[model samples]
Target: MSDRTRNTPEMSQSAASRRVAKVGLDSLDNLWFQVGGTLCNLACEHCFISCSPQNDKFKMMSLAQIQPYLDEAVVLGVKEFYFTGGEPFLNDEIFDILEATLAIGPATVLTNGTIITNRRARELARLEANSIYSLEIRVSLDGFDEPSNDRLRGKGSFKLALNGITRLVEQGMLPILTAVQTWSEAEHERMLAGFKQLLADIGYTRPRFKIIPALDLGAYQQNKIGPAVTEYVTEEMLEDFDRSQLICSNSRMVTNSGVHVCPILIDYPDSRMGESLKATTGEYRLRHPACYTCYLSGAICSNFSSGGQSER
Candidate 1:
């Protein structure tokens, strides 16, 4: 493990036991499937999970493994489903999984967008069209142009992702373009406008967008030169705050390894609640440093943009 990851607040059992705030599971509203595991086709410099071609710390889940959870989620009255991974599209049964998920509830997939071909986009459109529930595809793009995005994602990634978005647009799908907040807050408006214009140029006029705050994990943690999270959440801090804003209050991530508290903390051992969703219930302590990020940024992993509302 990286020193930064090792130094996370979750690692200090004694300190965490004393200072952490407990968050109970309000309901099982959102179900996330870690379908692709830690295996992406392209390894982005700032990836939270350090997903790559060979990282197998978590293995890809098969359709057979996921079906049982889908059935259970239905019984639990799950309102929405989310698919994420090294890259969810990398999974061979991604379409099948999405099809099954959309049949039950609204579904969203978090993808890097490089693997979305014209054929694949058309198929995705068909799935969305057939489903009664909403189907949202969130594409990750670091920048509006080639140089800026390629710098973080890798060479030739910008062009490929742009092409994929274009195809999705052509297939009548409105995808949510997600970018990490790599620049200062002062530059947010300028960067957002640039992205809007870029998407408009490619026929994605009035594109939906979401900005994500960078987390200190994966490759970012390995480098350990960025701003470090210094604050830990306390019970006193939740006095006047809306606890509903926390993803853990409404969601749980199902992975091949086990059912995790949330999608962001799957790498942390303590985040693994149990082997099954039914087995994982009750409250979870905000012990990881990443919890501070979530505390500061309400449900950062959700489909909606934070827009300063995350900070209480």
Candidate 2:
């Protein structure tokens, strides 16, 4: 057998099944809205989709572009919605867009946290009170301190992001702090503890934390050890593959390009479902390298209500 065949353990299975048992897209209670699409202000070293100011493979979904889907998603029993982008705040119609979304169900906005303004905080507060549904704001901070985080994110991002979090706390909205797992197991506790202390120092006594594993895609190609070999989903592998843990089993993301398996694989072609949400629900072959990370991380993207930290 060639080295390619040996390396691509699941390639044969993927190629064979490419014409059979195609993954069917299903709409679940949770629907992901690509409100910001592919635009983000701060380009991180390991962003799976390679979100940057210039990377507009998928453009921002405007309020008009998103409302019909929101209406459809609600009808299909979508209880929660997630909003992400290059930087969600960069969208000119963000508040208006969020107000429309908040009216339906719970909404979670994933942001880098530097651009959140005082006015935006007040708007979020208003939305929280006005809407029967809940609103969660997740701030992505790669590390606890500036020195560690700045290098991965960019210069002056750590302090500005902290300011955003502090403002959210003052607004009485407890935003979740999200970090990628880069530290050793022994170091994680210390980092989270320090984060808790730091949040407390900022007067946010109760702070929620999540550590996400890096998905080896986009800019992460530089970090790839080697191309991942996907094993065939045999009866033996089925024993270990927990169906409930995979994001695609429960949710699908709708971007300008179309529906995809999940938010993490928007940029990957194999993950694309179809032009509409209806075409995207079914079993995926689990071919991408990021699938391995998801298998290990399990439900790392969901929001947490309680103020506590969990390993990704």
Which candidate number would show the highest TM-score if scored against the true structure?
1
Write down the worst ten-residue block by lDDT for model 2.
1-10
TM-score of 2: 0.87
Clashing pairs in 2: 24-281, 24-282, 25-280, 25-281, 25-282, 26-281, 39-86, 40-86, 40-87
Q: Please, what are the lDDT tens digits per residue for candidate 2 over residues 1-312?
A: 001122334555655445322223344656776777677888777676777778788888888888877887766777688888778888888888889988877899999999888988888888998999889999999877898888788889999999999989999998989988767788988999888988898999988887787666666555442344353333344454555566766778888777788888776666778776655665676665566567667776666542122224
- In model 2, the Cα lDDT at residue 251 comes to 78
* RMSD to true structure for each model, in Å: 2.6, 4.9
C-alpha lDDT values of all predictions: 0.85, 0.74
The C-alpha TM-scores of every prediction are 0.94, 0.87
Residue-level lDDT for 235 in candidate 1: 88
